[model samples]
Target: MSRTAPAPAGEAAPPRPRRRIPGLGALRESGRLFALAGTTVREAFRRPFQTRELIEQFWFVAAVTILPAALVSIPFGAVIALQVGSLAQQLGAQSFTGGASVLAVIQQASPLIVALLIAGAGGSAICADLGSRTIREELEAMEVMGVSPVQRLVVPRVLACMLVAVLLNGLVSVVGTLGGYFFNVMLQHGTPGAYLSSFSALAQLPDLYISEIKAVVFGFIAGVVAAYRGLNPRGGPKGVGDVVNQSVVITFLLLFVVNVVLTAIYLQLVPQKGA
Candidate 1:
């Protein structure tokens, strides 16, 4: 064992060593993130809302995400339709192909696809922009000028993400449904009347409500994750790219977990139409 060195005659004794707590850093980071999310939500409804910034960010997010989301939905819908149609046919339930395929797309694939695109495209952009500003000390400058960076900057971006995600969810559902319908009719030899009728019979308003709710929740999650990472980047300018990537990955993981939870909750709370 090693002994401590003696202090100077008139000097105070050295301080005792503090124990390190495992995962304390991680826990603190998580707490900070949740606090920031709460602050953003509360501030979002406050007056003097940044209307112009909100509009601009909304347009930017939509612009970057719309075309790619549309293109991806086409193939995603077609694949879901083809698979479900084939399976239904094997089970001698081909008449329900439309209901199965449409429900699969709307209830599952559509929100996921929208969320993926939002996090990948729009979220990455948000992270990059905020991270860049942070590295450049712009956020600090704003603070020096008596502006709350989270309020003036983060709120608009997060709100924009939510709005864009909601609108894009609707677009994706419509486009994907059409794509599924087209593929099922053409490739699977599905009857148009039966497909339409089955969908109408099986689908309920709550289905749409759940989808939109998921979109909203997913959007909020993505925006918050991106903002949190951006606002707390490491290694300065060069690390912004790394922060963006981390935000995307984190958002994706969180989205899937949240999706599962939301889907489970929805199923538990909402009764089936024919059940």
Candidate 2:
């Protein structure tokens, strides 16, 4: 047997070598989120799917986000019309105003607006629902019963967000284009025939395809972030509130970054053609 000498009475043991790594905590959290996303994806493809839950979530998300999408899109269209029409008149290209407005809305505004609404409205709802379940020990109960909350709850919500986001993008595009048409022709005295005629002149099929893709990606990110925060909430009701706020902020930040990257790539791959 070996005898070891104890430390001096007043001396403290040397602090265990502090393991310091820049952004270690953030990296850990990010890894955990990615793992959670993987689990959700895996669950999504498994058998005995949650059809009713998916439908319910789809309806819920659509109901919560549709009105806001419409309201924002109409004004977005009007603003584009106002600005584009003013500039086009100066350049003697006023007939291009409708095309420009439609292109702008479909290419950029609708996807971003739909994403924001989903993050603010549907994402928050998911956080609240999951947080409530967490606080009530429902998640633990499911685990005890060998049931996965991820499969039951997260997958449905995520799929619903993605589906509704694409639908909402289409809705926003139509509403925004119509709003721009009304403002340009009625208010700005733009020729109706020119507005209608030039609408498809500058717009391309790729723009619509890319916009829908962006919507799907944004919705998936928002849903995942919301689910992760909600599932891992700490403290109590206040924690749930904090999680909701954080989810929205993170979703917004990620959406903007993704938008920039995707836009850059799209512009590189498919250079815009002149009308």
Candidate 3:
């Protein structure tokens, strides 16, 4: 058997070798985030619920995200309409421009817009608030007093994010669709009747379903990611800012990847309106 050498007086011992696995840290963080999401969901259903906290968080998230959602949606819809109109005209399928543009906005743009706004505004607020509590040891104090911070705080915020994202998805869809219609009819000289008729003929209920589902999933992801970073900020109080920025970036990346996956799966499973 090999024996380890002892350190001399007033000298520190040699550091032990650590097993470094590639991507282990990232895998561990992903696991923790998923665990946190599960805990939040479980705690969300347990009473006594944080009704007031949920309401306040919902209102606050909506307050911060509402105007931005509207503002962003208008430009997004206009661009989509213009691009689709140009393409359809080139293909001699100009009558289908409204259908194509509205479908793109509803199926793709709206949920993404809601996710970006929520992740930017609401997620940052959540991370900052929780990170401050964490650094101040308020979460620790609550644990000592027998309160589960996930139940009292995280759950409400997560629920609030979900509720607000769903509502905002609807808001963006309406505003964006109207904006697209206006741009197509007025700027592109598209007949209003043709635009409305084409949309009605091509738009299916499944498109709306997928959009709302994406919003809910994106909301849950944003809330969980922000809470995870907030609860595990490194380097003390100063690190909270870094964590907040990281959470937003991470959420944005996750949203796009998830959107692609969801869209692919929906296309595979749900048949098109006329197909």
Name the candidate that leads on lDDT. Answer: 3
How well does model 2 score by local distance difference test? Answer: 0.93
1-275: candidate 3 lDDT, tens digit per residue: 99887999999999889999999999999999999999998888899999999999999999999999999999999999999998998999989988899999999999999998999999999999999999999999999999999999999998889999999999999999999999998999999988988898899999999999999999999999999999988888889999999999999999999999999999999998767
Cα error, candidate 3, residue 152 (Å): 0.5
Winner by TM-score between candidate 2 and candidate 1: 1
Ranking by lDDT: 3, 2, 1
Tens digit per residue, CA lDDT, model 1, 24-78: 9879988998999999989888878999999999999999999998999999899
In Å, residue 204's CA in model 2 sits off its true spot by 1.5
Candidate 2 structure quality by residue, lDDT tens digits, 1-275: 99657778999866667889999988998899899989998999987899999999999999999999999999999999889999999999988888888898998999999999999999999999999999999999999998899998999999999999999999999999999999988888999899877876778889999999999999999999999999988899999999999999999999999999999999999978672
Estimated TM-score for each candidate: 0.94, 0.92, 0.94
lDDT of each: 0.93, 0.93, 0.94
Worst 10 residues of 1 by lDDT: 41-50
- The order by descending TM-score is 3, 1, 2
